[model samples]
Target chain A: MDVLKGAVDFVQNKTKVEVNQRDIEKILSALNSTNHFWEVIFLSQKPFAVVRETINYLISIDFVKTDESGNLILTEKGKEFISANNIPVVKNYTCSCCEGRGIVFSEIKDAYEKFKEIVKTRPDAIVEYDQGYVTEETAYSRIALMIKKGDLVGKRLIVFGDDDLVSIAAALTKLPKEVIVLEIDKRLVDFINQAAKEHNLNLKAIEYDFRNKLPDDFVKSFDTFTIDPPETIEALDLCFTRTISSLKGAGCAGYFGLTNIEASLSKWYEFQKLLLNKFNAVITDIIENFNHYVNWNYLLPSLESSFAFVNVQPKLNWYTSSMYRIELVKDVDIKNEYINCELYIDKEAILYKEN
Target chain B: MDVLKGAVDFVQNKTKVEVNQRDIEKILSALNSTNHFWEVIFLSQKPFAVVRETINYLISIDFVKTDESGNLILTEKGKEFISANNIPVVKNYTCSCCEGRGIVFSEIKDAYEKFKEIVKTRPDAIVEYDQGYVTEETAYSRIALMIKKGDLVGKRLIVFGDDDLVSIAAALTKLPKEVIVLEIDKRLVDFINQAAKEHNLNLKAIEYDFRNKLPDDFVKSFDTFTIDPPETIEALDLCFTRTISSLKGAGCAGYFGLTNIEASLSKWYEFQKLLLNKFNAVITDIIENFNHYVNWNYLLPSLESSFAFVNVQPKLNWYTSSMYRIELVKDVDIKNEYINCELYIDKEAILYKEN
Candidate 1:
């Protein structure tokens, strides 16, 4: 049954709120249920007299009231009581038609089939390696978590490398004031736009290869940005710099990169340096570490370049697979102390005194 | 080795910050490494090193930076450069420690043993049914998601029912102004308090039975509240009423009740009626018919109560064994529309409503 309509019907019947009879009938029919006497109904071709008893029982307890017009209504006292109390109305026991799965398996199957077909055509797409396409389960759960936390609201955000993850998150999140997407791949940009339409999401997607220049208009406007660029340390570094420039003071960013153990270790250093240099934003938490195959050739040189810039030491290890999430932030100030940068140049020396 | 200290050490080295030789030597000794070079460092023992290197590399290529004194930093030009440029970082290839499975079989066995002990005492206390005790894996993932979403900071919240989930979520959240827990079970309250201390979290666990009157000081103070009452509908109603009274106008509340489909439905109806009568709050989402086990006895009544309240239909269903997270908000007039309470119910209903 259309759960929403069913809810409306239940509210109407319980609260004595006058609603269209046709709407009630439509809802009942959708649920494949037929009303018998006053409150009794049959479901799944089985008569259920208990429903009537329960409704009558509710009336007896003064929880519900019926008007002279035969419209069910909560009593004046009941209404006031419910409002002040902030109570939730029971809508339905279980959606009989869907068995409470929310979506019909057939519909899901069809969507999955379509998703698979689209994936099949893109043999080179990295999504195919990790379950073909993203599921609402993964996307919505992540989005809901964000909303609950307040991260997706009122933050200037940028999406680096438009993909299912970013687009889905953007679509589901409560609209931030501004949402910017940097996409070098035209096909991905078009796909993101189409998906946005389907979801009625407002996101500004720009087609620009991040390896070059960024749009001049985006300087210093963002508060939070996400980086999930192509797998290469150099490219990652480039993306980091551009996004960092557009952030407001104390702004934060997140990145999800694909790297091997050595590369992951190497990129970790680069990520830290970028965070420290740009916003002084600290890495608060690491998200996850999972495995997938993505081309990393382009990122390798950037990784090498980043290695030359800063020195790093390992602390803790956690992983599910090859990929990992590392949290970082701008370095904290310690009194008025300063370190000599030249000390890092002597790689062979274990000890160097500050001059 | 202590993870936090290790991180501090790695950052110190990577940034070329001056640290006493003793401190560096101690850190190295703890990590079981003799070399200053990060690349040759043991993978399992040096996460701080890995993260430092990645950040440093990003900084070196002008992706990130640090000042004369070795403090990790990100440059504004660097931020603009990365996103605008579309840089990518190398992916981690393998699990340095376990090689991929994330945990050694021995660790799994040890965890299993601990789980058995926990289950022997309180079987239902642990979530993720198959897993015995809470694992870092589950905790970290949940916490990470919460952080990304922004649920972790700067909000005033109350948790109704102190349990492992509530306590853990509160602890892992980034930062909040305050966290108040209302628990009926005194033992649970004690447990929560101890756990909070262990985690160094600032959480207050108050012992208050919902069946009794609410403390006057708590009226209309909370911005968000989570309700997870016992399986009894009667108790549920009392708890719901008290919780509502404590919420500020426009505040949201989430409830996770037991499964007595019929009773739940009835209770939901009553609850909604109460909300409408009192705060004019509306139900925004409902998840029923979840894939998890349903405690039919409690769920039925809860479902019934939830249904009879709102005109708007629920968007989601809760049929699974997983706990339900419902969102609701108090309805307010922003543009001065004459939302007549009289139109919905008569003056008699006014008696039951709280101002």
Candidate 2:
């Protein structure tokens, strides 16, 4: 595959768009956003020193043309290249009722409620104390929200940790091409697998540990991955690395749940830096209070004794985590850079950190 | 200033982080997103390659250290550099009820309603048949939505064309550092300037035509600009270039409204390519149906006699346009590239294009 193919297919006799490194970069940048052209030209090292060369390259390739006044126009070839490549353009739309504010997507709300009703009736699954489990509403919304974000359009998806059963909710949509859940808990693995089978969904649960290197077969094999990572910097890094490893390439996306309640602003700052520095990924969307955890009344006893939850259980579970969607902007291969960290953080320390 | 400073600052007797281009890029990249990083990265070209040299340069400068595991960690100097730079991070949290979905941002709704109530009382502004004015609700929401997006936050803003009075509504917030409206319509200029004075809002409207080069003082002087250019490719290109010309630099943003009714997907596709090819801008968001034009009952007589609207008044304002937020990702100077085009289009032909 020619890296500079500019999202064109070569037919036996068709002259392909003569795309160069900058042109390819330009096209990829265009796919990222119809408006982010300035950013693409300025942020990356190409096209500037070679401005004349790049412009000439585009014109020479018959992808673009300049009218008498030098206003750039896309040639039919250029337009065809863009249409054929189907470059993903960043969507500027939100729900009309919600203005993408999401409150008005009551249909989603209803679906979430139904999803929760079903989840409540399911057999009791082992609750991992360290991996905070969200209320069913939040879990269902997480799935619905991912769908809204266009992450599950018949694309292969990998859930790094699915104690939340997003996999089941996603399967309910029957949208993803494949759904694979990697979990350390045998109970969850069995439960999710059972649900997928019962629903006849394109989903599978695999027993996997984050501490081990990601399976070679899984590297760069999926379009998207979702995770609720341990809130510690070390654990967060591990989850990110694993998620990056599983992603197909640039433009591939990952969703993760993070809480300000446990992770302080500094932690957020550090983790954000890590994503950009290591993966060249940018956080595209951050939906706040997107995930509200179910009050894990049973886990109180397992908690660090000093945990103030040691007091009375609040009537309502107010714990909520923000959902983040990070998209890679360039071709980044960090499979070897995947770091291993304890999947479970010290609950007591995290609770204390919250305080 | 050294471009390789790596988000650090100079302190007397303080050891500077030995930062290479990559390290500096890593830090700058971090700063941009935590606050709109993609825009910063796209507008300027850096942090793309030159890896070995960049790394070696960093090591020689001593801004980072590599662990035996080969993990690159920031040194004290590097950390100091990042701290000193204090790059803005992207905000992830939105209103809880709205979930940043925007349903509950009622203050905007209220402001919009109030603006509409007031607008209705004003004498009918001369209806320019070529420039469609949206319904009062659509107009108010445009202003309110801009606020929701943090575009009006104490930043110098330019509205390239404001037949919609978005500048007046934006000024109503009393949040912007400054708001300037440039328009060819003398009626709009006088009306908006009067509104700003009456409201004691920091807004100014000047009678300026798009056909002329942007004022020299205004070049790269504003943080953001908004326009609703004519649907034709020629007009869209002119408005975009003028908007780019007015932007301060990378990380600045622009907003425009385009409709599927008048602009076909082909037009959309061509215009998008032009944005990337000419301006290097990236579209961050496109909120659909955000602008509903107030039906111009008066323009029926002036519209092409073939226009069916010539027969009967449509009760509903059927025209809706998507609002797009395009941010500069890199440093871009389009002062020279700004083009001029006829701002008006043949209504009948545009409607025919839609079919």
Candidate 3:
């Protein structure tokens, strides 16, 4: 038992200050009397890893013994060892808030509710068009909070493909002076225009297609843009480019919905690189599952052959998109345009290209 | 209101089949009765982004009007349009678990309690040596869960450093066939060795310095390894290389702790690339704030003069580390050795160097 001998000698001779403390005798008496070693272990705040091994070694050397119930009892050698050595006591560290997770959002519920009220009036998704609409409560909550946080209000906002109709939420706030939607769907554009006119809201909509160039009058006209583009890289890149094109200059903000269900981390990495390095944008916020779309049953019929899980038709609406906010960190080099970045990748493109 | 007229015309003719459904009449009646448009909106489950604007436009065109208290009251025109149009109702999508974050650990409490019990005997950190030990509960929880998940049981486990004494925790289970610790601290080595002998645990410890090569017998001999190295890239790289070398082969598991407090996402990206591509490992799990270290007051004295925030002595133990589990996906090439990686960047090291 040289290990125990060395530890005892170290405690007795090396830690003179601790050994001389008035609390040593009381601690020894407590340790000798306790049937449950865990109470003593807890009091000492020494980890289970260290204390268990120490106890096992001491017991092996006949310094301690276990009762019928497996509780530890100090033998004569243990009593003598305790009297000679200085025991270390450490406080238990506990945080009731996050249970040590560190990331605690205390007022998130209040905030979520508040935002939900603000976006309650937004549009319904057209299932026939592969439109997956998030619940209005979540939509309003996210958008309203962004406005409350001063991320959206007062900015000249643009909606790239306003299928989600976030422009209406922005307009209703009367926070932003102008809200415009560049929509591909004629019906939605017409519907939004009629709504804006009736409410006397500062919102307007114009028919636009991603396949075409940006209208000259709309280019670089907005201070912020919100988009819920298709997840394919080609479509995402194109919509992202259009959103960037619509921004007024550096310091502008852009919001977009991206889903992990369709876009993997590698895709996210590439997109982030494009936004950060190529476009000089800095991502400031990423809210996971900020948008959970209602059942997209129409898309399922088309996807069922490719995705067996779709046939299950579980009641759960599993599609969710994370909301991201990126702010321009440097002046936009308008000359470095990527508007023509492919909006569709051909199957032939899958083949590895020659260097 | 040409927009409203066109929308009505398009909705009536294009979606006649949906409009004729018997549910459409029930939805219209529900819409007409409720002052809360969100109810109809929810029934429509159409996202507020798309719906609100359409509603606002319809209201503007005198198709819907607000009652005395600002609640929507459908006009005769709105009633007429409702019968002729197919209204989209999107259902609210919510996850009872995780509030829609998608990752839920339901039995975390039970698992946590079990681990807490397992690690109750571990040692307190020796703060003088910059040993900011995590709570025994969390360490035990994580390690035990790993074992329960079959990541450690029946495997030869290696711990790069035994300051946390995870090797002891593993050995106590008698689950792992063998547990070895390579440590720089002599006291810990002696302490672990003694505990192993007394408990008849299959565990061993060898004192080793960071600057030296790992002993020949240990290399490529382990089925799993765990390490929590310093935050610096050089230290992390060196420690990671050593841990990788101790692994048996492909399909082996490894766990390590890294913190955002010191390592930025860019640094994480680089390290992930090295693991996924260079080492041919796949990251299986990442639990944030999985390790919460106690206050490292000893190192504060050295850092206090350099950092202004130290004077505050914040009550919260703000330091946290995320635990990562990686599994070998293929044979490790081991070509990119980091045995001599610079632990600290020297003045001369800043100069540009050609490979």
Candidate 4:
């Protein structure tokens, strides 16, 4: 099959990234054993772009094909190639209880129950704002993780977005000195504020877009900040610059959620470098598949280009993001300045069209 | 109190590391709230060196003092500095159940039970060999975590040391293609080899030290490797060079445990940079306080040099290490070389005497 040469050729022809045969072979080995598109990212640890590019290359060479039901299937040629290479299929071994997060909500059972009850009236996610709320368990788990890290409780916390109403969950503990949420959706803002007042919690919500600079009083004033940032490189840059700018100074903490389904590991690599090199931050924790979201309605045939590859519905809530906790070792230099490192764009959507 | 100038002078006179006002202030603020040497690192997110230096400086000026019971106390002047600053005393909010590890042994109940039973007869730790084993729960948790990461099943695995017997636990699962342990202590080697025979497992142990060059056949031969390395910078560099050299190529994984009590954040920063810049490895998971070690006898009267700060014995097993999982994105260049990376040194021991 000359798979090595074929993969090398495909990388040079189709992508800007320099593809390594070993990485490609690794992904190919994992894919050869799976027929579920939903499980592709879970199967291989390679970057999202490389996996997608490899699958695309396989499709181009008539080696693998997507079923009408959204499942993956190897073509006869692909089967032959895999057999010739003697690739063994490895079973997925992630723990089913914690879902590979290595954490559960046992310690925060009361908060889990409370968040679950309060989120019943939470606003629905809208495609316009690129919003998707996490499960209530995830919401409470985030609160628990922060408290465990000593970033919560008697600390001033700022949440970048409240789509998940994580701010409300944190305030429920009545531990933090204050809880402030800057969200673009007025519905969520009003809902969170209503909840805060009714519960008499030290929390408030302000309707704010992340692209705009934070107010002077808000900048450099928080002990910790949390956000589910957009996946695009530009948007991620802007979102982080704005959110991180709110930190009082060094020893401050920030929480972020990055997804494997949308953001490639290359994007993760870039963001990680940005955190360490530019911001002088040390990443303390990253738990994979930690933030599992409620399946939103945006991808149900409404998003034609994205859903085209998946002709049918996914059986599970597969949109999960890794949770990150980072501490700034140096003060951010810029504050109260308009920040959009560049215009935020959704390149994955662009890839959808091109592919 | 002129605490700012005090810290500035202290940094200049006491340490080689760069000191920033914001970082020192953050540490001071968090420290003003607590008095336990064990709690110092957890109180603030600053690097270990800065935290240590700040505390030492406080003692120099009679701002902080140690109680005979080992608790930290503020001198009359230190009390004045804190009151003038109005620094809030933040309560420790770590989850009591998980102890901030996030994951419990709920899912691996059977494996947890089995590992606990088997490790009962394991070799006792000897400080001369830098040996201290983790709790049974921690040993099983490492196995479960690796399985959750999809790095165990049908993959060749290697262990740099066997003091923890994590290799034995993985062999218990009967999942890996092969499990090999390179350990320095023959007691551990014989014990693990004996366990392999009794359990009918595909695992073998060889009495090997990390400073020696890896055998040719062992180089670039494994899919995954795990270790609890010595925390000195030189030891860390050499140990990583040897263990990482055993990986097959890109997509290979490594697991390591780094203790906060021994290694400072500055060392952590340097090691992290080595992983990213030198080897092109991507860190996927890092959970703090994930490895809780059993209290060994070495810290009693036998280790007076390190225990000088504490007159009384500890009430709990305060020694813990963070767990890390990293994946290689590129192949390592060197193989089978006597790699000392500058003869392995333990400067922390020297610091104990000098301080």
lDDT of 4 by residue, B179-278 (tens): 9999989999999999899888899999886778897889999989999988877888788888789998866889989875666555676777777777
> Candidate 1: which docking quality band?
incorrect
lDDT of each: 0.38, 0.57, 0.55, 0.73
For model 2, the stretches where C-alpha displacement exceeds 4 angstroms are A1-100, A103-105, A108-111, A117-164, A173-189, A198-355, B1-114, B121-129, B148-150, B197-200, B262-282, B298-318, B342-349, B352-355
**Stronger candidate by lDDT (1 vs 4):** 4
Clashing pairs in 4: B35-B72
State how far residue A185 of model 1 sits from its true place (Å). Answer: 1.5
Q: Write the per-residue lDDT of candidate 3 for residues B1-355, one digit (tens) a residue.
A: 3444454344434322111122232334445546565454333322222233344545657766766544667788886775455322222222323222223233334544444564456555664333566765556655654553345645688888877777777777566778889887887888888778876889999998665777878777987888887755676677777878777765577888776444534345456656655565655455445666666645435433321222234355446666777766556745333256555332111111112
Worst 10 residues of 3 chain A by lDDT: A346-355
Q: Considering DockQ, where higher is better, how would the candidates rank from best to worst?
A: 4, 2, 3, 1
Angstrom error of the Cα, residue B260, model 1: value is: 39
Lowest lDDT block of 10, candidate 1 chain A: A343-352
Q: Indicate the docking level reached by candidate 2.
A: incorrect
Against the native complex, each candidate's DockQ, computed on alpha carbons, is: 0.01, 0.05, 0.02, 0.25
Please name the candidate that would achieve the greatest TM-score relative to the true structure. Answer: 4
Error of 3 at A322 (Å): 6.2
- lDDT per residue for candidate 3 within A218-310, as digits (tens), equals 787887788887765677767766778777765467877776444534355456656665665655455544565666545435433321221
Docking class of 3: incorrect
Evaluate model 3: give its lDDT. Answer: 0.55
lDDT (Cα, tens digit) per residue for candidate 1, span A1-355: 2432444455445433223222232223322221222221212111111222233434555645455443445556545544453332212333233222222222123333443334333323432211112333333323332332223444566777655445545544434655778876666777766656665666667786655556666766665666544333454555556666665432234434332222222234344444444434433222222222223222223223221111111111211112222222332222211212221112111111112
Candidates arranged by TM-score, highest first: 4, 3, 2, 1
Over the stretch B92-166, how does candidate 1's per-residue lDDT look in tens digits?
A: 222223322222223123433432333232324322111112333332322222222223335466777654344
Give candidate 1 regions above 4 Å deviation: A1-149, A172-178, A261-264, A277-279, A290-355, B1-355
